[model samples]
Target: MSVCKVIVMGVSGCGKSLIGTRLAERLEVPFFDADDFHSQANVAKMASGVPLTDADRSGWLDDLAELVRVEQKGLVLACSALKRAYRDRLRAGNPSLQFVYLRGDMDTIWSRHSSREDHYFNGRTMLESQFRALQEPEPDEGAITVDVSELPDRIVERCLSALGAPDRTGES
Candidate 1:
């Protein structure tokens, strides 16, 4: 998809990885899940149901931002990006980077999360904490907000359609 950069973002288990993968395939770009970039210590903390402080996330965010900055072609990164500051961090020096917000209720996401058997972020409490930290991308942020409740194909189609026309909903 012509050097299109996008971050599929939401809480821990709102299908970021899943949808990000599909989107990347459609766009013919690489897909990276931020969970794969977490430090061992941070992964352990979340695995034990502990919420991370901003300090704990600093290095990780830097690493992701570096990846975004250095990548030569387009890519879709699946990241929680729960806070606006974190999103802004990723955007540094990568102003054209767009975001796809998987907007969903706690119950729907919790149901999807609970069914996972091998994910590191598996705590319900941690999910709640992420929601608390969430800052949905605003209209001016040049983002596409899609419902997570729909079938995956529909979501991907919506993303592709929205992407085909930038600024259709302030997404350029």
Candidate 2:
């Protein structure tokens, strides 16, 4: 399989990690969580139901960009790159970067978030903020936006297809 870097990006509860992990496994590459790059203070603030300002996210975005820049081979990264500016930052140093946007309705996201347990993003308070901050990827942005209501396997299939994977015509 040809290697290519992809970022599974979307709002909170949009299954960025789940899809990114599956994509990584399918591509035989490492998976990185952008959340892991956040500073302790950022995590603490989010845990406390605080919305992060663009200034607050600058460092985190830079770190993610660096990861993309330094990866010798393609890797999958899960990040809530909600804003165009943030996405641009991630793509700045890595000209070959591609984004797979896990798009979903607000209601669907809220339902998923509500059912989850022990996540740092507590499903409430930040939903509105996330939506407010979201800037849909333009056609010119070169992102493949997929609705994430499908099963994990199907999602993975679609992502692989988006990445130009050949048709096997065997598995469901």
lDDT of 2 by residue, 4-90 (tens): 899999999999988899888878789999988899999999999999899999888888999998887889999999999999999
Quantify all predictions' global Cα lDDT against the true fold.
0.89, 0.88
Q: Model 2 reaches what TM-score against the true structure?
A: 0.94
Clashing pairs in 1: 167-172
Native-to-model Cα distance after best TM-score fit, residue 88 in candidate 1, in Å:
0.8
Off by over 4 Å in 2: 166-172
For all candidates, what are the clash counts? 1, 0
TM-score of each: 0.93, 0.94
Give lDDT tens digits, candidate 1, residues 24-87. 8887789999989999999999999999999999999999999988887888999989888999
